[model samples]
Target: MLTTILNLLEVAAWSGIAALGFGILFNIPKSVIFTVFMLGFTAGLIKFSLMYFNVHIVLATFIAVFFVGIICMPVAHKIHHPPVVFCIPPTIPMIPGYFAYETVLSVMNFIFMEDDQAKRVELIDTIFTNGFTMIFILISIAAGISLPMLLLRKDSVKKIEE
Candidate 1:
């Protein structure tokens, strides 16, 4: 129980760091900092939970992105500008950088270790498959959130013109 709480705290800390960093960089208002923090916190929770089940990082990224995007949609709507910027900063917690770096290292090791062709092949294959999955998740999140908003804006413009 203690360990779980500690782990949760750690997740919160990292999420806050990511959120605060982006918020400051983008000049988001101090009043909205908590909102960004929570967005990042939820993304971290989703990523960590999926990672616990040994779900591929790509799938995990997708889940985090989709969940955060939906949760922030109403907030985004209220902003009346490029609300996707909010989601982009908040999604930083779901980048899976560690997994990606490890995957790259494993590939490099496999290439240099000339004795085991089979292991090399396996490493390379996992890199491609898992990498593809991760990329797809990131793209899906961006597309899923942005496309609807874009279309809505276009329709509003058409109505104004008419």
Candidate 2:
């Protein structure tokens, strides 16, 4: 659908900006900024598309990151930098900040609030749900993003000529 694609594009743009900030933090060189932006944009688009299709968020993240990793391989080969330089930057935007933040808030509330039996149980439930989801999603994204290195027949980085 045109509307879906347009929405995806908007998500990609915002995600690209986030990834660009991470790229700067990661010391990614200026020359590859576009590539890095595209990486995040594409990853976010893929993830969004899968989610739109009613895919599980964790599964969508894995698929998206795996796709990004595959795409990064050739780009890294062409640019002569390590694949991680390209791969990790894009995945930055995929980090589930909302879930992570909620997990933290849940823990803080559980710890700081005076113990009422009903409230304590409720807080624990929230913490477990958000915390586990946050941890697993992060792991899923990292694993998916890095799997290419393990699975690819070619080396991820070129050997420097001495």
TM-score for each of the candidates: 0.68, 0.88
Candidate 1 residues 7-94, lDDT tens each?
9668866986897698789888666777778778877777777877898766676777777656665665555434555677777666
Q: Cα miss at 123, model 2 (Å)?
A: 1.5
Give the per-residue Cα lDDT of candidate 2 at 122. 92
Q: Alpha carbon lDDT of residue 16, candidate 2?
A: 88
Q: Provide the lDDT at 84 for model 1.
A: 50
- Residue range 129-161, candidate 2, lDDT tens digits: 988888889999879977876775545345422
- What's model 1's overall lDDT? 0.69
Off by over 4 Å in 2: 157-162
